[model samples]
Target: MSQAWLRQPERGSVGLLRFAAWLAHHAGRNATRLLLYPITVYYILTSPAGRGASRDYLARVLAEPPGWRQIFRHFFCFAQTILDRVLLLAGRTDGFELAVFDRDGLLERARRGQGCLLLGAHLGSFDMLRLLAVEQAGLKLKILMRPDHNQMITSLLAALNPAVAATLQPIAGPADMLRLRELLAAGYVVGLLADRATPEDRLVTVDFLGGQAALPATPIQLASRLGVPVFTCVGLYLGGRRYEAHFDLLAEQIVIPRSAAMDATRLWVERYAAQLARYLKLAPYNWFNFYLFWQA
Candidate 1:
């Protein structure tokens, strides 16, 4: 179900993002936002895969078949966040108000100078989480992701603010892994989107939203190896330039003994998936992995 998402094409080009950014800066948020309507509708009609995926997810979450209006809202939410990403990366949140909930774990970790793995899903705007957490909490946050995952989007954001690309530690090679080790040992918080897996990644099936799906086991594996605490984070878009960030400690420390490595990994992956499910419920439309997740 997910290999295709890994192989899916990037929806927008760098030129599009540059134009959107220019519009936001010159025309302003309200006027620039007017473009999202036609853009969202274009995707709904052209990208049948995305449209069908949205409908399927809504069907399960709403407990019935969803209509065109609901599907359009889902697409609109996704488009809005994407448009805002340009501004968020440019360190502009003037129009947005963020409310963080239950961030004690992150604050405590920072106070102790203990590094952590902040595990987040495709839900909501992770750009907001990284922005506000560092701004308000004063945490040195670094992101670990597949560098080539979305070269188009990555390039666009980097063009908007080059430092955004500099902070990302790509997991495409072992050197990046070694760097991640160093960052954690040096007591810097590292964030990862743990829900999707690349072709080279490992997976473990877990129950999510009433069905089983393959979640990337790499995050748990690294935590077990690094001996760092894991915290589940979500940056839920509350619409209209408002967001609510939620952080809950998932594992104070993931200790997987060698003998029971298999069992231990399964336990934590399942735990993460369950926690992700809970966060999805808080902002159903915020879920942004526009791919079928449940295993057939």
Candidate 2:
């Protein structure tokens, strides 16, 4: 993949994140949460891009443009999730209440020594599920992330706990692709976020949140190539300290015969998009793609 992803700047500063981390650890989670009201207001007042994105997304799903309060709540929720990442990564999960709904027994019945791909989105904290796999089951889960997609937040999160950040993998050229294949063969679950497209990635547009939107087709390619089931995982914040995670089996298998490969991939991408849209409806504020997602 091209390094265009590196050029896409993130919203926050590393210095501010580091300061938040210091406050969370030294002053405690509750003590530092007093900062979110101001932080949310700052973003609402200063960041038009993110605020517009939030309102645009909300309007599509809510069937009307969102009020300032609803938009403010969106930013505040995102802020809370980021703050909780510090605690979750630092092994302070006792303060959180997690409910995992694996209706298809995806997480519960995961093969102990086999590898599969976990398809997640930018909706909620994908890091939340990492704690479950890393601390509870000890599964060999490696996340596939762009090299510099979230440079500021990534660096500060890594500073808080280096172990979790160590699992991020890149799937750019042939060499990295070979490594990912080898990891799967070696019984490692490779997790990838399939919600957005990188510049080098081919876009697959489908109906999402009552509008047509483009999402990356990489996960379909990987699941078919590796001959593994793709499981859909969502971590939703219900408010305060409660978060619900659902790990449902999305595709049993994806077989793209050479004669009809393009058609097959589009069909599969549409299926994934429909499922993602349903999850978005369930948790409106949890949609965290703070950008013009439906736009180019």
Candidate 3:
């Protein structure tokens, strides 16, 4: 909501990224992960804004104020997720362990050719969700996102897996909406991250992690407009190579009357924020929003 995150310049260059990707492919994940320590320390020493944001967030969720070591670990955790994205995109998930908890909901929906919305956050590895759902389970998924923020990384990752890149639906233009509708009608799951709000997004303040935070209302509004099933989903990293993909039905269909659209959207966003807080508490370091969250 601050829009400050959007202003933060991306770190690293195409060469560094290409090298990392090359190292991941050549040296293997375990060996490549040895590089995370120096990378984490470098970022910790250079990025004051991200470090301060981590400390502020930890103070709210953690029992005590976080120390420098904890902040370093936070950066390390983020680094791990990014590294895993490379392996996942490259179809090298044999070493990773994934525990999926969808019950009969999402799988049943997909089996019946009923597409739904998977509302996620920036808390963990979304690429893991894509790996399990699309690759393993054979579900069609379209990720709705704005890839222009980190164009360099986006382009590099797109190069790693062009198939995944093809599934990306940028959040722009009237034509995308029509395409999304067509995809959903054809039983393609559309995923969107609901946590970060841009300047143009409608903001809804909700109680989160002992403080009030502003989240975008657009995802809920979109669900309401589409009148489709909405599911709250997150892929949480549980240390090492373990991950948990959790999915719970948020709504069968969101209906907002024009009379009380504001109130209705607020309620939906509150529910969503509550779900996000629940998962974030489970893996605090998995949260990657490196900005003054509460201020926004």
Candidate 4:
């Protein structure tokens, strides 16, 4: 979880990813993406922890009939295929064809000389958002990421994409808080992935996907402290290298009511969780949470 780990080089994993990327690029879009379905299914079914979670969740989702669960699982796989095609095309086309939601409103709000929080999830390519921010919005976006265990993979992914590396600012400890505050003061948009809550982090419990789950309270707390607006941005993959970059103004204005920081944080987190649920329902497979989201 140290910042130094994120700087290491990938030894061989990059090669495999590059090959996969090439296949996704050269082969017929639908065909190549479809071929990946079995691979994903095989991994999900073969992995002990993953299979158990998938089975349990599938059962819960289709409690009415046993056959219904299998049918939906197959449909989910089909949807994943289409989503992969859209993602492949988005990368190949360099984001020109990506459909963006609330393009003007997001920018206008950002340009209003106030700090804003850009909250995203683990659903799709967040790096794509970095591209849009730098290329389209003319802004240097900074992301706060939880340090990954696989240092090599983290470094390689960052090094492979210069646009993403240039704007990504890795945060390790409380020491970086001042720097983050300064960035906000300077009107730089700060991006945070809010779906996962680790034991080491402060979290707020909320109902997500029809169950109770703990979500990171950092983003809302930071926004409240800075007295700024908070927005939720989602990149929905449409087929053929097109993405619908949707943005919702979660909190048009974050006000720290006198000594009520905790209450304000809870309110915003509830609103965010509700919106996230709606989007996940619209595109279930788009949710990339491999682990069980709701833990008691």
Local distance difference test, per candidate? 0.81, 0.76, 0.83, 0.60
Clashing pairs in 1: none
Task: Give the clashing pairs for model 2.
Answer: none
- Candidate 4 lDDT score at position 160: 52
Best by lDDT: 3
Global local distance difference test of model 4: 0.60
Each candidate structure's TM-score, on Cα atoms with residue i matched to residue i, is 0.94, 0.91, 0.94, 0.77
In model 4, which range of ten residues has the least summed lDDT?
1-10
lDDT of 4 at 285: 42
Please, what are the lDDT tens digits per residue for candidate 1 over residues 104-184?
878888779898999998888888888776546778778887867667777776777877677677778878888999999
The runs of at least 3 residues in candidate 2 whose Cα sits more than 4 Å from the true structure, single-residue gaps closed, are 1-8, 13-16, 107-109
lDDT of residue 181 for candidate 2: 83
Clashes of 3: 0
In candidate 1, clashing pairs total: 0
Deviation in Å, model 1, residue 154 alpha carbon: 2.6
Model 1: lowest-lDDT 10 consecutive positions: 7-16
